[model samples]
Target: MDRTAAPGQSHTTPSTALAYLNPRYWDERFSEEEQYEWFKDYSHFRHLIHSHLTPNCSVLELGCGNSQMCEELHKDGATDLTCIDLSHVAVDNMQRRLLSRGLKDIKVLQADMLELPFGDECFDLVIEKGTMDVLFVDSGDPWNPKPETISKVMATLKGVHRVLKANGIFISITFGQPHFRRPIFNAPDFSWSVEWTTFGETFHYFVYVLKKGQRSSYEDIPVKRFEVPHVNLLHEELESEDFAFLINVDELNC
Candidate 1:
């Protein structure tokens, strides 16, 4: 939780405060030789993704940021894989890595998450890892999100909703709690089934599985029965000493 700059890292400034919102910032960050992982890798959550994925499932990863999750998916028999990021630099880097490894089937592109170029209902799965959390950092207030922050997040969700096939699954691995993220998935046009798992002991994170359409038998339920409403709440479910389970009834219908 240290916000101060490290020995070589740049100091925070007005421009740098919301750097994650800018493509140039990510380009510069990924241009460095050292790789950084925001949270756990695909190995930790491979079962969750694989359980919902078919061998030939079309997968899309939003804001991939040089992560190797797609490569793992490819090795695991997912053939139609695509990854998108706002930074061309990151995309190029990923392309080179994939190419060097002979992973030609996985496609990498530079695109904004809010305005995905893909047609409607094209993908069987859309996966996000730490992408929305970056938006929260860009908002300058993780707890009290600004209007623009919510707008950008909603736009990205809408785009994901449009691109996913009926019953397609969207899995997001994030540090955000259900209270902060559930409303974004509670759309009237689509019914959703959501479940979350907690990882790590002291510094925990959550993996949220959001399935489109009515609650299905394939979906996993980890928590006791509860409903998730659409209304925004201040400081709700923000503090936790031990890991907890929360569900959105509006989405889970359980």
Candidate 2:
């Protein structure tokens, strides 16, 4: 079988990368990995995350996985929170963990981010850590990705946009650079004002703060209508540079 990797991201080929989108993969992974946090853990950016959150704000975390982000948030005084993940194993493990810890206020549900199971204008803040990046892993030609790639990413963003209340914020923590991520984020359809701050010890990780209805950048792509896209990923390596390069090179710029 022939497999190909994007210029800089050789960690996984496009063909194999598809497995990263499967729920079963995560189910098995979370069972064995014991405890793993994608990108930096909550402590690394707690101040930054807290800046956008209030003690009483309603929070929704997409692709909760096995990360302790929600637990940390609850400990810090934010209790009105719900977490969702496509993998039943991850949801089940997280639920059990929360229960054993005596934290019942936080709700963990098995869900897909592409089609969030929540009402519109319900959450004050919707956030994802490395959730949206999964949509782009197998996305060919990051500069000019395939139609389906755009569709999947757009569909998930639309769901996020739909569920957020007026002036609500969507926080995304990713290895995606501004040049690669902003167009989709700033699209006219989302109508969200975008601001970003980078954090990391060696290579910078982007934290995009999209304020609902702010519309700072105007992107005029054909809007992908709201739909339930069933796709995802979980593999993340600190994002090294040996994978791609300076010319027309991408794949999350790994």
Tens digit per residue, CA lDDT, model 2, 14-128: 2344556666667776665445566668888887788778769999999887778898888876789999999888888889989999999999998888888999899989988
Score each candidate by Cα lDDT. 0.68, 0.72
Q: Which candidate has the top score in lDDT?
A: 2
Q: Could you tell me the lDDT of residue 193 within candidate 2?
A: 83
Worst 10 residues of 2 by lDDT: 238-247
Candidate 1 Cα outliers beyond 4 Å, as residue runs: 1-17, 138-144, 215-254
- Tell me how far the alpha carbon of residue 58 in candidate 1 is from the true structure, in angstroms, after superposition: 0.3
Write model 1 residue lDDT over 170-216, tens digit each, in one string: 88888677766665556454466777887765556788888877564
TM-score of each: 0.76, 0.80
